[model samples]
Target: MTATARPAEKPAMPHFSSGPCAKRPGWSVEALKGAAVGRSHRAKVGKTKLAQAIDLTRDVLQVPADWRIGIVPASDTGAVEMAMWSLLGERPLDLLAWESFGSGWVTDALKQLKLKDAREIKAGYGKLPDLSAVNFDHDVVFTWNGTTSGVRVPNGDFIPADREGLTICDATSAAFAQRLPFDKLDVVTFSWQKVLGGEAAHGMLILSPRAVERLETYKPAWPLPKIFRLTSGGKLIEGIFKGETINTPSMLAVEDYIDALQWAKSVGGLDGLVARADANTKAIADFVAKVDFLDFLAEVPETRSNTSVCLTFKDPAVASLDDAGQQAFVKAFTGFLEKEGVAYDIAGYRDAPPGLRIWCGATVETADVEALMPWLAFAFEKTKTEMAQAA
Candidate 1:
């Protein structure tokens, strides 16, 4: 019944979908011009590019010398599954799940792997499971950051350095944008699509010395797929860790990944990436601080994610609504923003609590985030008015 003035500006680049996220600031089709297109991935040129990607990954992420970094198949999921299939079942497993991806791992450990010695520790959305309660003596599997829930373990302080069993971490969303504790983790898996915004299906797997020892000695009871096999003849497959992949790889995608890694070096490596993500998250935090109706889905401030920043309606009028109503509100709010071309794909994960999920990864510009904040408020106001009138 009354007209409202909208925000004067919008985000310059509104391509935030969480996974297969926004590309580098100056990226274009020309960035892939040098791709070894239609060439054999096993050839010298393709191998060189793949090796460069791995080398850049180590140099930029500061991976330790002894650690083995490999380009694997599938995205982060394939890498994580490869680790679980190759490494688990030798010892008792402690599976931890606080979000969807983590929960998928739990299902794999229990229902799929049928690990009778496994125990599951879980927490609801926006909160982390008890890190202190984790049995480090038993092989522990967890996600460093809960992408769907917007919760993350603050640091590696809770994990014991001298633990007997290995630590398998799905660091897909945490890699590049977050500081991973290499010493405390035995196996780490991520994909370039998250922070680097590269093409998907290419997974990166990093293994510690202890994990190598496990592969060399212990074997899972179940059979591993050909591509999932990480060892041969009681020894680790050294070639897999190198540029020689088990399965065929996309030279184009590999080249794009290398391009992204080169860009990462330009931006000052891991520290720079983390700073950029933090700045983007801060832009949202400042906006949330000024608003009474919206708050973080993550209950604890420290646990809030720097990448997949999830927000919820704290206003009683919205919070008191049932699940469907909450979902409807978010749909309306995000739809309004999308119609204005200020933001895109900011909806929370379907399994996550009804709310807004904005990707604040390093590939996104802080100026865009700041510009989009006012548009969020504007959209919310419009959605509230329209919904009320319809009611």
Candidate 2:
């Protein structure tokens, strides 16, 4: 195939990375001017801002009143590790994984935590595991959104409402863009840099009353890291839930999160955010439908992720190549877009199959994704021509 004509219009903001995703539209350095820098986090002003972030998060997410939300140290990884180290081992565990991040948790449960009785249910990159077979009587650990493979659970129908065990979810990529059933989830963890596009190095941990009860009632057999500690003397530490973090936090990041939350509110709150992400994904889906060579990585339309929208080259010539050759092709294809200033960081994750992963989070404007489609075609054709010529 010959190279297609160069796209006339370019995306106004060409950042499409899945993590540290594009910032909210109209975001600027001015947004962080109100940060309480150089001050003790224990001060009333710093704590006030921290509490405000939690309050706004509760409001935006519509979390249950009895649930506890806290700002934990590290990113989403820390919050998840904290939950696993602190809460698991008391009951039998069921680990579900379909992609890179989800698989990592399974490895942690087996090798690191050394949980002998944990059951592992896994699937290939594009598919989901059997949710029906998952035993709700055992503690369940899974990622709400498989970021690398672009597969997200369509809803919370799979989770049992009256399960005796807890549901620990890593929802970093789904929090703002997807509708999470808080009542169905016992433990949910996310980061500032995902759907909201805030600064990194901070994690948000949301826990149901049941999760807190588990913390207070059961104790892990292994040693707990100071940073992962959530309780004192068998009682839940209420201070962490009220802005008193276990360690010092970056006020700048907190302020940036506040800005992102405020933007989410201005754009019609959670409903608006979900709509914006859906529109962006719809634009990409529309484009992919017209291209014979390109298709979504997710085979099931219902389970497709609206945030991390991954695509694969379905052309016979492209798919025939080995994994190394496919990766080389992806490099050339994404490099073309990067050079054209139409997209950036659009390549699939290192652990995922060779493809393109475009973030369609609320922060990314639909117009930009629409503009990017033509550029995507241009790059694909150009790369194909170069490969043929080289052959």
lDDT of each: 0.92, 0.95
Model 1 C-alpha lDDT per residue in residues 249-307, reported as the tens digit of each score: 99888888888888998998999999999999999999999987799999999999999
As a whole number from 0 to 100, the lDDT of residue 345 in candidate 1 is: 95
Off by over 4 Å in 1: 1-4
- Residue-level lDDT of model 2, residues 228-276, one tens digit each, is 9999999999999999998999999999999999999999999999999
- State the TM-score for model 1: 0.98
Clashing pairs in 1: none
User: Candidate 2 — worst ten consecutive residues by lDDT sum?
Assistant: 1-10
Clash count of each predicted structure: 0, 0
lDDT of 2: 0.95
- Cα distance off (Å), candidate 2, residue 111: 0.5
